[model samples]
Target: MAQIQASIEIDAPIDKVWSIVSDLDSEPKFWKGTKEVRNISKEGNTITREVTIAFKDSKCMQTVTLYPKEKIQIQFTKGVIEGTKALTLAQTGSKTRLDVIWDMKLTGMMGMFTGMIKKHIQSGSEQALESIKQEAQR
Candidate 1:
């Protein structure tokens, strides 16, 4: 298993940040690499989403759960990389600190490219945070 992480401080209150993050339909506006997000199904608190990445040739199916203002967890149910990811939020004074962690497992020969995958995830996380911050601050 490989893990990648990134953190950013958003110039917004935790409530505003949580509101933006919890809105599933607004995901693509702030999520990096995601070109489109389609809600496949929803059952209570769990939702299945189909996500298409901008440069990727294929899409991924993920199960997502929102824990209000605390965290958002995602598990890759079907995709090239299989694993779980999370976004955690903490409020400090007037700012909200957002942390993103990606825990992924590669298959076959892809396991040899762990370093590249980690870099990719870290970069994506940073981009996603910046986008989210902008949206939340607005």
Candidate 2:
């Protein structure tokens, strides 16, 4: 069990950020790794999705449960990385703060490279937050 926590300040009001963040299907608009997101089903505030992330020779399937703009919990039901990720947002002053907490374990042979996995994920997460900030500010 490894954990990575990070946050970024977006230059936008909370509502403006929420509007973009709450629309789960818009991830490809800001995230490069994400190729597409399709909502499989929704019940009330929770949504289940089939997420596709582009990689060499593969298309990863991530089953995710999203709680609107408050949080998103993900499990990679089909991929080399299998674990959980929770992303949340909060308001700070007049800006929006996005925070990410990732708890993950690598699948199969990849499990042997725990340190590398965390570092890689942390780096990717930081980049993703930066992209989110840019998209929200636009």
| Candidate of highest lDDT | 1
**How would you encode candidate 1's per-residue C-alpha lDDT over 2-103 as one tens digit per residue?**
888889999999999998888878877776667788998998888999988654445888999988899999998886667888999999999999998888
Clash count in backbone of candidate 2 = 0
In model 1, pairs of residues that clash are: none
Candidate 2: Cα lDDT at 66:
61
Task: For each candidate, give its TM-score against the true structure.
Answer: 0.87, 0.80
lDDT of each: 0.84, 0.75
Given candidate 2, what's the lDDT at residue 99?
89
